[model samples]
Target: MTAPRQRTLFGLLPWPERQAVAEALRTETIGGIVLVGAAAVALIWSNTPWSEAYEQIRDFHFGIPALGLDLSVGHWTADGLLAVFFLVAGIELKRELVVGELRTPATAALPVIAAFCGMAVPAALYAVTAAAGGGSLDGWAVPMATDIAFALAVLAVISTHLPAALRAFLLTLAVVDDLGAILIIAVFFTSDLNLWALGGAFAGLVVFYGLQRFRVRGWWWYVPLGITIWALMYNSGIHATVAGVAMGLILRTTPDKGEGVSPGGRVSHLVHPFSAGVAVPLFALFAAGVSISGPALAEVFTSPEPLGVVIGLVAGKILGIFLGTYLAARFTKAELNPDLAWADVLGLSVLAGIGFTVALLIGELAFPGTEAGEHVKAAVLIASLTAAVLAAVLLRRRNTIYRRLYEEETLDADADGIPDIYQRTLAVGANN
Candidate 1:
């Protein structure tokens, strides 16, 4: 028997208006571009002569003297505000699991396997590098991330040279890669915690979900409580970012047109903008500001943490994703998307290696100490830049070559109404 939907989007406005607004919200693609730009700026800052001021600027304080939060520059911005990034991530994840590509195991299998390999092999490669070279293997997990913004940005530039099958594989591969990265962070990267605060955070989550049950449409009611939940979780053993994800999930629902707007669309409308625009760009400005003071370019390679991360992201990611997907597709007997060739897969695999946001994120958490974090930043830049270049070359084939490369097929739009522009772009004026 179906349990009745506990609530709907009924509010001061008509339900249709609310849903229409939500659909409009879902369609905005500007956030993705902003995020890509942010990652690029951060990498550029870390690698440039301005690294000293960039890193030091974050140490400055904000707020009134009496109770000002003195989170270091990056922590204040990346850790604190980036929690909102996690919140949006949580919403996307919930939606995907409920009604998107992840809704089917058969469809999900190749990407899922590819994601697993992409994450696993990089860590293993880093571990080998770390242990053999007198590095800290505890930092092994740092290189397993694939930054979607950077990856997408690269895809944006090179989409015209690849086939549709290749583009689809890359998107699915990246999505699953992100899922794996989130799991590693939640499970592997946290520090010690306090139970009382944890309990409070749990209570806040319950309250948030309870609002969903009651069909609460007022976003204000949920936002403050979400912040409170973050504070409690921060004070508790759980990472503060986890709190964002928790709160975001509570308020999100799936859309089904009914007597009024769908409950799910209301939350999607409200959250996607904040997450994509404000949260991600701000995160870029903050996280990317590492100054180039302490170490020279040559020094980065000598540092174990950064070197490991660079190797992992560049060499390990490309090798692992290509080999893993190839093996899994062979073994699982999963049907390959017919439009792509093996060469196209290889080219797109290079794009998969552009692990900017998440790699640096892991780098920060893994090497919390000052100089160590710098090494992580340096290595990430090296690897990301290398991967970005290689992807471009691999994808930079002639249109005529790819035209001869594959045939036609249709693709679906993301929940956000943007069809896979990457796939569409790949066809590049060919007959659809």
Candidate 2:
């Protein structure tokens, strides 16, 4: 973890985690850029005259079928590659709980409270809108997610001057949001419960846990066990990705002095790039190819389902997060990081509305094999773009101020009594 510069105005800020978070956010930004490009390509291909080719590629199947494992390429991307992504997410969740923001009750409350509102307000808004318009209410959870990578990427591009604490806040909130989304999938989205397969998945998870308890350090041993757990979970009528999360959560995160890294940290280091760089982009490519005709685009406004998703993501997320954060601080008597203003929080809250990946995943689950799912995907894209643009507009000037502050904080031009910023300003005035 990197220490924050001493000049930060936020007296209550946790500076120690700044470096680790910045690095993580950088990686996520890169992944997010790739994800966006992939989705763009998918959209172009799907909307072109060669749209059938896109469908053909997406629908192509290749897997062991005898054991009920045969699936389309898109399905494999959704179930398999996304399991890897969730494995990293699970590791992050454990890391935060153990050593990051969620380590303390006081430290955890702000983001937890914010994430609760972030999810709740959107769901409430979506449900009410859907019911009022007499649309199916299954897609309520679509707007309850926050795409951490996408949001971080937006911040990276548009708010370079924002305080590191703001990035940390957004990251923490997104992690909690992901946890909520995962729980929703496990609870509400599961199909038929296959007891035998579920039991087998649990048994595999137990063995994986036992390996870490006994200090087994080889990837060779853990990888096979993880695969078995994922496979069993897939057969168990629950999302297979939950197995990844289970495996990640159970891993040891505290490193020995001699070993130099915890099992979870070591694996996360090795796997995170793959998850962000390859798995997620591939999944995006497969999942984001929605062909929207002009009528369908118009339907997004009139139809309750897609309209609700857009409103829930665009308006509901920002409003909910801001209100939740304000209320939490008021109730808890905690002050906002002084370096950050309400504007910074508002920018981040809008960024949180970029609920691309998991939102689309939930859309699939919510309306599987239906045109409604396509509508949901389009709506998510539109909402995310709208949120990103709004965040950029909101944070633009703040970025310049932040940039100056960062320069002043980091600059040490001379070993004299005065700081470089003052010297530079004095020099500029003299020259003028």
Candidate 3:
């Protein structure tokens, strides 16, 4: 007899699809581990007796002074190096829009809605708390971000048996969250507009677009152009990282004739390693090195800013995402993927509260060089750690259930070409 066809659910994707997600997960997991290690080292070093040395290294400046480039090591890591991470983000965003799950409205609705809720609810919570306590409202956006590397790393460790669709959902939600953070930085956190420099940045972006249209093929040719665009954007009032995203979006997403890879894919492939392994870790190192002495810890507890941030990240993220997902499904008649459960979504949503990277950036922008800023940084670190611990505890239980399901989906018996579970499923469906 011909073997019965298997039902594909979010729990068990097709092999090729699973392979793609697995590879992406592997990359993010490694990067996440490195990023976390760097942050931990920074925290330890900063709080130790050698804290001044860490500050000295971070504050050392050596770039050309004439070109307005005399930035400290910390600034360079934050502004220059982190652009690589944003570039990869932009490329991934484009791919999703053009050909991935986000290509269709139906597929994109849930995560997009959840991402929006995730951002909005956190901002509202922070604002309300900050305002009620007579604290500055500047850092409201700090809690609105989801650190993809940190979250994915946590997932990789605790959710090894989770469905591929869950990974994809988290990835897409985080990407959208990053995009929202970028827009906030550009719009609300900008300095006074510098029109001439802004115009120059746009001109460079146009040229960069033209280069891609002409099928320009080498990293060497694009590097200088990318730098020039970054410089112009830096001089513009907008954050320079937006330039990287613009360039990334400008690159073609699909391969040209006789080409093995698209420009976007090629650039991402070349830059991801550097961005993940070096740039992000270095940025985390500088950004995370906040001294947390007894006094500092006391300040974190007494400060309204940290309290708001903590609540926003830990409580706001989970409630917002779960409610948003439910509302989206309810109003749109979009069913949750068959292989996943509401409980799985709840666990993943809780894990999403681990906001580290962009939260630190916004904290700096919101309260630069102030006591409040330091408190905000301390709060982010603490909140992320809390979220990580909570997620591990919650997801560990769910992991056992998923592991059993995963095995059932993969196991074949009776010399059949199909998994025995699927055969039984098909037989049950036929009887029904």
Candidate 4:
């Protein structure tokens, strides 16, 4: 070998990396719990002797058709419940844009760009491969979502091997992926006009925001209001679930109020756990129930259900997100997140391809990827599973390579009579 590579310095960092690693691992475990629990419940509901009961869910009626309809379930559970998931997602998205990562365009640039790349490439690939068409056009959005729960789980699994910067990059990128999914849903999959219902829903959301300012009490304080918004949106022809997002925004706690001290903080504390623990888990259980007893497996390939979802989520999500982020960064001069290398970015981009929960939701309404669209969902599930396992493996390998490289580089610098950290510091002062 010509000469051994030198350590880049972070490896020799003075502070312990264990704490940060532990935190990342903890976050990952939560993520894994959510995914495994949701996936497990879904399989049970979809495959058992109760399969018929599960499939009939979509057709089950919930609201009074004549007495002014309300949210009901059979099949509505998957779509309606998932709306809660979207609502949380939307709430997170809006919050990020306001005060979080997406707050400043500059700070937001890297992930925004990366998210776009990740989305566009996957969609284009899905369309070409699946020749996904006709009514299928409506479901183009299926693959655009990142399923942060699943993606986060993958992140947790791969955390040990990844650098801190790469972890930051994945989090940011996943949000961007969620943004694409939301926009796609709002724009592409909506129904015919329900102007009256929509108008009322809009007004209710405005009132909810005002209530937040007044420091509303108890989680139930906004419940009636949120329910009304949901009802209005449902009748208004807008997807009723959009109301969940509206509720999140309205109910977001103010930071100024704190420590059982502020009403806002208390409310957030209550809602955060409730939403994460209860609402999200409920949504996952309902949404994951897809029916498998349909035409033979071979017939599924030709069916729109499997083809659309499989291609859209697996092929479309990755390609779109990766390409969008890549292009945005390139032309705009936005930096990749500090710790992430192109290699790291690319691997996580593969994980972005996982769209299990949200993909299932879209399949029900626009495509019906399970009973209605198994061929498509099967494809999506297979692809997503494949991507998750492979990406995890690759990230582990990359981490090993990085550790070995760091040691070699450090040793070489010492042999050359230069202390890596001390010499670099002196050189900077000399240059100054």
Count clashes in each candidate, considering only residues at least 3 apart in sequence or on different chains. Answer: 9, 1, 0, 40
CA-lDDT, candidates in order:
0.69, 0.86, 0.85, 0.62
Residue 415: error of model 3 in Å?
5.7
**lDDT, candidate 3, 313-356, per-residue tens:** 98889988989999999889666665567777888888889999
lDDT per residue, candidate 2, 7-87, as tens digits? 658654465675454355337667788889988998888999999999999999998764469889998989999999999
Model 3 off-target regions past 4 Å?
Answer: 1-26, 407-417, 420-432
In candidate 4, what are the lDDT values of residues 134-215, reduced to their tens digit? 3345455566667677777777766663566676667767767766665666666688977887888899888887876765
* Global fold similarity of model 3 (TM-score): 0.89
In terms of TM-score, how similar is model 1 to the real structure? 0.79
| Tens digit of per-residue lDDT, candidate 1, span 1-432 | 998856556544567875665454343234556775776687677667886776677566664233223466667666677787776666666666677666788877777777788888888888887777887887788788887656766666656645555655666676677667767777787678677878988998999888887767676997688777877777665557878767656655564446254555555556666666666676767765554555555656776667778788887887887788789888887755656556666766777777777776777787776767766776776787788888877677634465443333223555676555456445543532
* Descending-lDDT candidate ranking: 2, 3, 1, 4
Best by lDDT: 2
Alpha-carbon shift of residue 405 in model 1 (angstroms): 6.4
The lDDT of model 4 is 0.62
Error of 1 at 282 (Å): 2.7
